[model samples]
Target: MADLELLDKSIRRVPDFPKPGILFYDITSVFVNPEAFKYCIDKMVEIYKDSEIEAIAGVDSRGFLFAAPLAEKLGIPMVLIRKKGKLPGDTYSCKYALEYGTAEVEVHKADVEKGKKYLVVDDLIATGGTLVAARNLIEQGGGKVTDFFGVIGLPELNYEKVLAPSKITTLINYSGK
Candidate 1:
């Protein structure tokens, strides 16, 4: 079993980060602590170890942090879902709304094997726009997404609604319980 207390304590909450009134759950703190980072990967590994997921599609930058190790452990290929134009060769892209504006994500067409089941991963799930966009790109490229995983989630924001019909899992949730 994973130690929820240690993982929760490993995260640092920054107030008004990138803008005012925003309480950012900084996951970089996990990087500085080996135990917590290992715990995270171990937990996620446990979650999907017996599953039928063929690949992991990680969202740009942060998502790669968690996905790479998970894919390695599962012995599956890791696909990168990057921002528009970041990937080379023929690509599939999708646009999603952000807090301030819209952003686009893309995946290399070659990375996606048609009809293979994929799992989308990220550091956290706040509003779900990015993950939803990632799912679209994967499907548009002929890959099917079986689930979404985040290290943390903010249910207070009601993100599940935006990501409706898709299952998502998170290790920690800040819902003011």
Candidate 2:
């Protein structure tokens, strides 16, 4: 078992965020702590380092932070997954439901080479909507998503129903209890 004592300690929980009856796991604290940040990136790198990953694909917003450092450490290029219409020039998009409303995300069609292996990174996995959308964009661009990595995961959400069956590795887990 991967204990997340330090990882949990570094995370700050915000209740009823963006909607009622929801508690969001805020990662700014972990982002600020040098040891914690390095631990997270290092752990992720350790697991996927031998996965023959050619690119580090990060989900929009918070995912960009970890993806950048992970890419640098792994000596690979990083692809940024963004909200719909955020990317310019021949992009791929996927729309999905949010806690309150519908939203869409996009990626540059040329970001990844065909048949390249990629690891998708994100800050959290609540409903797995964002990760799945990102994976869709990557596949649409012809890259194979070998794994989905996150800093936190909520087991209460239907992860299996959303994301394609793939190796999911996380540094911390808060089951939405």
What TM-score goes with each of the models?
A: 0.95, 0.92
lDDT value for model 2: 0.84
lDDT of 1 by residue, 1-177 (tens): 358898999999998887987888999999998999999999999999998899999998999999999999999999999999897699988988998999999899899998999999999998898999998988998888988999999988888887777678999998642
Query: What would the per-residue lDDT of candidate 2 be over residues 74-130, giving only the tens digit for each residue?
Result: 899999999887787789988988777889998888886799988899998878888
Which number leads on lDDT? 1
CA lDDT, every model vs. true structure: 0.91, 0.84
- Write down the RMSD of all candidates, one decimal each: 1.7, 2.1
Which candidate gets the maximum TM-score versus the true structure? 1
Which residue pairs collide in model 1, if any?
none
- Per-model tally of clashing residue pairs: 0, 0
